[model samples]
Target: MHPSRALRYALTLLLLPLGNALAAQVQVAVASNFTAPMREIAGRFERDTGHQARLAFGATGKFYAQIRNGAPFEVLLSADDTTPGRLEQEGAAIPGSRFTYAVGRLVLWSPTAGLVQDGPDLLRKGDFRHLAMANPKTAPYGAAALATLEHLGLVDTLSGRLVQGENIAQTHQFVASGNAQLGFIALSQVAKDGRIATGSGWVVPTDIHPAIRQEAVLLTKGQDNPAAKALLDYLAQPQIRALIQSYGYGLE
Candidate 1:
């Protein structure tokens, strides 16, 4: 081989590890309802940008408290737009760095097939032993569920059967495990390819409740972190947005 070609080959080999060396790891706080889609996005983010996102999933309100208390999370993907906006106002997050990534859809779901047909009528009948939902004070989906019940004027009628979960994932588990006959959950929890992939579900109409606008923001700690910015940018990419849509969320 020519001397110049050999030197260039040696330089290329030496630089191969540089990209990995420069890659950063960011800690991300993610809302429970976004679990599945966020996991997919994180994986794609690492592969495409060589930056690893370490995700922690839970209720958005709880995450807000954690962030204010100096949690190590460098980014936040909240279940509601309000939390992010509040964080920005409190100076916990970078102003103007937040944007709605998904508009969530609520669903009445049951592990038993056909059990969720005609959701409103079923709820009005009030025959079920238990109906699970997230903690309305913390999870936006839970608030939407409450709004839905109020819209149907069944809150008082069904008050005796309500079961609350700490987060939407637990709410889903309550129904999936037969502890509750059915539950209100994020559609993404049981959906794939824009359809419910599980036993049965009724997509709650948006007109009945407040829209769950999910927002992503760069936390104050991540202001100088490349991986944090990269992850947010990755989520905004056309392909990632399409993937989010496939999981039953409407894009902003």
Candidate 2:
């Protein structure tokens, strides 16, 4: 009944096959912007290997805070390269385990017809009453949106009309629900098989916005986990990379 006794029994369980199977399941924290593709990848990883991958999606900012606060995530797939690198530098992530998983793209999208037919030109025309974007302070997609607007020299001009979502999913929701009329969301969200739809979108040229290289890192806490390491390695294999690319990500 004592705490030490309970821990001893728990440790003893690891010697059993059932305990090993459960212990080998990898827990992952993924960025909301990459939700769709990650689902595909995680499923494949689980099927090919007996090890399961449990996934959580949210703003990278929120996930990073959770990981730092000691959330039990074994792997982190972030929307930006910097966060994983920072975690490594801070000794939160496993050293030498960080790598770019995908390059993301920002899209100015509308569910309605003709509202955003020709990209930035529609923004200048300003027929829509509202626009949605993620919090630039948090979502990398939001940061890309702000950068694109600035490149078009429309930031101050459209500042009053912006409705900022907490993350990329909410931004997509606002536009899809027609609450905001238009929104800047991840290209992957609106894609069927990694290509954009025709209702109208501007695949903000990679040249304009900052390069969005989404990175992944196996945390130092999970270094000894074979499942976590295998999953990360699976992501880089030619076959898996092809699958990811088909989901609209530029794999590195």
Question: Which candidate leads the pack in lDDT?
Answer: 1
Tens digit per residue, CA lDDT, model 1, 163-247: 9999999999999999999999999999989899989889999999999999999999999887787777767767888999999
- How far residue 211's Cα lies from its native spot in candidate 2, in Å, is 0.4
Deviation in Å, model 2, residue 195 alpha carbon: 1.6
Number of clashes recorded per candidate: 0, 1
Q: Pick the candidate with the highest TM-score.
A: 1
Model 2, range 1-252, lDDT digits (tens) per residue?
Answer: 234434533443344345435446788999998888889888876666556789999999888899999999999999998899999999999888788889998889988766676887899989889999999888888899999999999999999999999999889989998899888999888876677765567778999989999998999778888778777776776777777788677765
Residue 187, model 2: Cα distance from true site in angstroms:
0.6
Which stretch of 10 consecutive residues in model 1 shows the poorest summed lDDT? 1-10
The pairs that clash in candidate 2 are 94-220
Q: How close is candidate 2 to the true structure, as a TM-score?
A: 0.89
| Local lDDT at 41 for model 1 | 89
Which residue window of length 10 is worst by lDDT in model 2? 1-10
The global C-alpha lDDT for each of the candidates, from Candidate 1 onward, is 0.89, 0.83
